[model samples]
Target: MTTDAPVSAEQQRREEELVERVLRSFDGCADPRLATVMRSLTRHLHAFLREVRLTEQEWEAAIAFLTAAGHITDDRRQEFILLSDVLGASMQTIAINNEAVGSATEATVFGPFFVEDSPEISIGGDIANGATGQPCWVEGTVTDTTGRPVPGARIEVWEADDDGFYDVQYDDGRTAARAHLFSDAEGRYALWGITPTPYPIPADGPVGGLLEAVGRSPLRAAHLHFMVTAPRCRRLVTHIFVRGDDLLDRDSVFGVKESLVKDFVTQPAGTPTPDGRVVDGSWSRARFDIVLATEEEQR
Candidate 1:
């Protein structure tokens, strides 16, 4: 090896030593707060690189891939989140933090496709249009564990088009299949939408490249996304997955939880949805009740 190269053995040693020195900087941290977390993260991350014998070329490629993921973020999209989803990090975090949630309501990864301030729709409204799936009506009651009603509960919902693309992804305005509804006096909430079909997550960018490199497929099971928050209810961001979606076990994000999976029922066509959209025979129905942990419990 030539000594004149940009980096030599001595240079590599010096660089790794510098990393070690930087990692120890947080030692004896009286706060034991952020510093503790930061130092542990540093140790594990450095160990991972060493354990994998990560190469310079691979590191550079990883940096470039992350840069590209950041480049795709916009007002309506977050590529970093998409990357995290494909990496299974997001789902893991959700699972770790929500371990105590009972059979009341299951939480899942909130994808990069959510649109806040969803258009308001009435109970029994039809959220799906131009769908080529089953026919059914979604009905459920939002309540606490004691089965007490939760009135005026706000439920924000969204789902992919029949083609597996969200309205925002297609650059469509806040339209059908994405709306917010509130629980009625009975703490009952219902909506009508098409049966969901397994769809691929974004696979045209750096995230896609990484997935391909890792031999992982970029597919999410058919499901409906919901974020429910009320004054007294512990907020929940979850999905109702299709019972038999082909991708259930292989959800690219690892976002599928057994409790979150729901049975998709089919009803007759031309059934008048509470929203006044006549079901065209191809629709699906799901029922999920949300339970709230006390505010103090969440804390």
Candidate 2:
């Protein structure tokens, strides 16, 4: 019978020595968690380099690409997040931390466009704030896993305009197409906004070049981002995608989840809304109930 030859002592020693040297470099890390993370990262990174037989030119090119990505990042744009999203690292990290539990809404990527201190509006108030699109009504309840109401929960929402651009994309630094609303005493919430439409993630930077090189499309499925938080409950960062958006099957960032898809029922002009809001033309409505995991469940 044929058998493989054993690794020579000299070669095995050299391989071990390389890894050991890297680990030893982090031996003085004061934080236990940081040390563990750095050690693990070193092992995998070295393994990847060895397995690919990476050349010096390739390493230099990778460094240059990362540097370019950083150069394009600014207050309004986040190229590193775009890179992580395209590489599936963002989604993988979310999956590791957000396991399903008790029918709570499944979490998804918090895209790079989110901004703090969005203007607050009451239920049935409009959040369009000048940006144009087909008006949409979003209504929902914030409830605990056991069907109990989570009164006074905060719900922050944001979405791209019909032109496939977020508020931050504008040069004037104005806010539009986003709002912050709170649930009432009965855990009910509603607000008016624009219907979501399929859009491409920003593609003018190094990450975009990488996507083009790999023959991948940069389109993200139509969806509205929601961040719901309540007392003593886990905060949920998720998106409610349009049920029939063509891009749903192949979201560029792989953020689409079956549980998060919902129907956006279209209504013709003059349709009356529950909150007595007037509609001048065709509009859409989406009902998305958020189930928040309790503190205990999160543990």
Candidate 3:
């Protein structure tokens, strides 16, 4: 019998053969791209397990957790994104395909909050849907490197209310703190919404169990999500984090970028402001600029 050192030469050959067998099943597959991806994933996954000497019980536990993750996924939410986020895989994938922007704003994770077919709104329209929460006004401009306005750019923004919960989580049968807006004749916009609050990613499923096992906290700092796109410009899908937030550095998904952080300045009462902007008492403002890349889309 071979000692439990690493693996016998025969065992190594068997492992390689097992990987080959799995790849061979993809023969005559319609989607060649998917086949290639499956092959790569299988090869790397098998090799990693072997290299790490994953125990049988650990492998079973992983499988059980994955089964639970799939069971939790349904029509309303995506538990897989939550799993990937907690494992930092989602951010790593985004980083690999992240756009390069010297003068433009960079792209980040398109978290699982956005839904399909949001109502189109005007530049200064309030997206809070009149939900009860603190008043926050976010304003920004969409322009290129030459300071030219990128008119007609669509800006999609969403975030959780002050209670640190998305409307989808509340079963309210409505979309809260979400809106899709197109820039007017100019590249300016002022969005009004509820003040954001730090929220824990879906932690009731297998993902939460994984976090517990790793001794990691799953708190994501408060931030507003935005997805901006324009013809001939790089599409941005990211978040603008509140500067000085306590959980900024400890984002469970590792999605915080220093460039994306901005100060939420408090405007004193009765200050001169734009129409439909700040009114009587104290208000807050966040100014952000999204830079679009000419060479958009990952190849």
Winner by lDDT: 2
Tens-digit lDDT string for candidate 3 (103-159): 767666788778777777777788888565666788888888667888888999888
Residue 57 in candidate 3 has what lDDT? 82
Candidate 2 Cα outliers beyond 4 Å, as residue runs: 1-13
Whole-model Cα lDDT of every candidate shown, in order? 0.77, 0.91, 0.80
lDDT of 1: 0.77
Best-matching candidate per TM-score: 2
What's the distance in Å from true for residue 17, model 1? Answer: 5.4
What's the distance in Å from true for residue 107, model 3?
1.1
Candidate 1: worst 10 consecutive residues by lDDT?
Answer: 1-10
Report the lDDT of model 1 for residue 154.
90
Clash tally for model 2: 0
